[model samples]
Target: MIRAALTSNVQVKVLPGPSAVTTALLLSGLPTDRFCFEGFPPRTKGARSNWFKDLATEERTIIFFEAPHRITESLEDAQTAFGSDRDAAVCREMSKHYEEVVRGSISELIDWAKSKDILGEITVVVEGFNPGTRQFSVEDLVKLVIKQEEAGESRKEAIAQVAKANKVSKRVVFDAMVAHKSGDKI
Candidate 1:
């Protein structure tokens, strides 16, 4: 669609404007060298959660677009996938008369969203994965699965949860579990 729009004979002069994502990125003072733009999140809860899980360990700053009606739910899902304390910025009505930018942890953003009537084009900028935190190994993943199972999750559900939380494949977690059970080094 963008290609077609630019190729049309109408002689279009494209000029840059203060989009919410760009403005938010500039305001956040995060590393600008490496960044990613994830246009719009999936509409469904399951799909969206899965997508967020996939991106949970992204090292580059991430940007996303959201509608007013779904912003609350999206924030909730983000809080689950990215954790409640992950840093994020919510930019609403960018460059408009009522432009607002709210920055804080995911949990704080969720609370703010709940207390207001959020109307406008919303853009969310989330801090990328920090590798300095505790890194999970295959053995760690196995232990996590075991803990989830002990906490009442089924074997399959535990594997899935561990895989998603570690940003790895379910097959990886399953293979790790099998290897651990067989007393083999993982």
Candidate 2:
């Protein structure tokens, strides 16, 4: 039946897990210049948590592929790792028989995911954290400043460079690096 339907309509779009995510991301009006497509993380709790932890500092939109059986757990993991307030979209069985789209904060999505018997492939699109508001560790700030300086930039110039590269405030970088060098916390 599925193959027959495909044969009848060449223009028909089969929005599977990843493709549905791509489409949703494209329509999100978010920056598409750079993005990461993360298919399903490990099914087990430990590995999955670790996997999500790795993505905590990612600065680009992320896509996930999940099975219906695990949508609730996945959403829960996303909330725990990325924070409950993080904005995201959950697309399930897209372009197919049981298509559904859910969008909201990670916490809300986790609640929604738990209340139903989700069917088919699931695609999740999550917003990246705003770089300006994020507080990097002093060590990291120092490293960034040093990297820019090594690129032939002065302290002032390096602070500016780090700020612009990370979309944060120049003062933030400067203060962090200065505090690090002085053994003080900003």
Candidate 3:
């Protein structure tokens, strides 16, 4: 019924709200030059995990919406996929009487969410991947490959897995592994 009431002559504009994307961006202090709004993430754990994995290497600031009930679980998934130390902000009840914005590492936010009875609409803003600041060491890659191997992945499969997780080429992982074997610095 609301859709039918609109016409080409209508110059409708979205009402300004505190929890809106623009407001969230302002609160986050993240880069605004490039961004991607993902809306709501998948509800299921498996699907949501996969979605987060796909976005792990995104270079643009990411935005998403979540309900109060699911905020904790969503933050948990985000922590797992983006790492506990990744910077993020959780904005709650924007434009409302009790508007709040919490900013910190993903793990800290998760801890905060667990202790509070969150209410009202929620908006999440996450910092994008910055390669220069967070490069994984060769030993780190080896540990990742070994972890994957322990989980039933073959050597070749483990290399591929680590490469994908680190957003690097498989060849790079292989080269690192070989360097480690020969006692050469990567």
> Rank order by TM-score, top first?
3, 1, 2
RMSD of 2: 9.7
Per-residue lDDT of model 2, residues 52-150, tens digit only: 866876889888788888778877877766778888878765666666667678899888888877777677888886655665677776886886677
Highest lDDT: which candidate?
3
- The true-versus-predicted C-alpha distance at residue 174 of model 1, in Å, is 7.9
Alpha carbon lDDT at 12, candidate 1: 25
List, residue by residue over 61-117, the lDDT tens digit for candidate 3.
999999899989988998876788988889877766777878789999999999989
Question: What's every prediction's RMSD, in angstroms?
Answer: 10.3, 9.7, 9.3
What TM-score against the true fold does each predicted structure earn? Answer: 0.67, 0.60, 0.72
Error of 3 at 184 (Å): 14
Off by over 4 Å in 2: 1-18, 27-30, 134-186
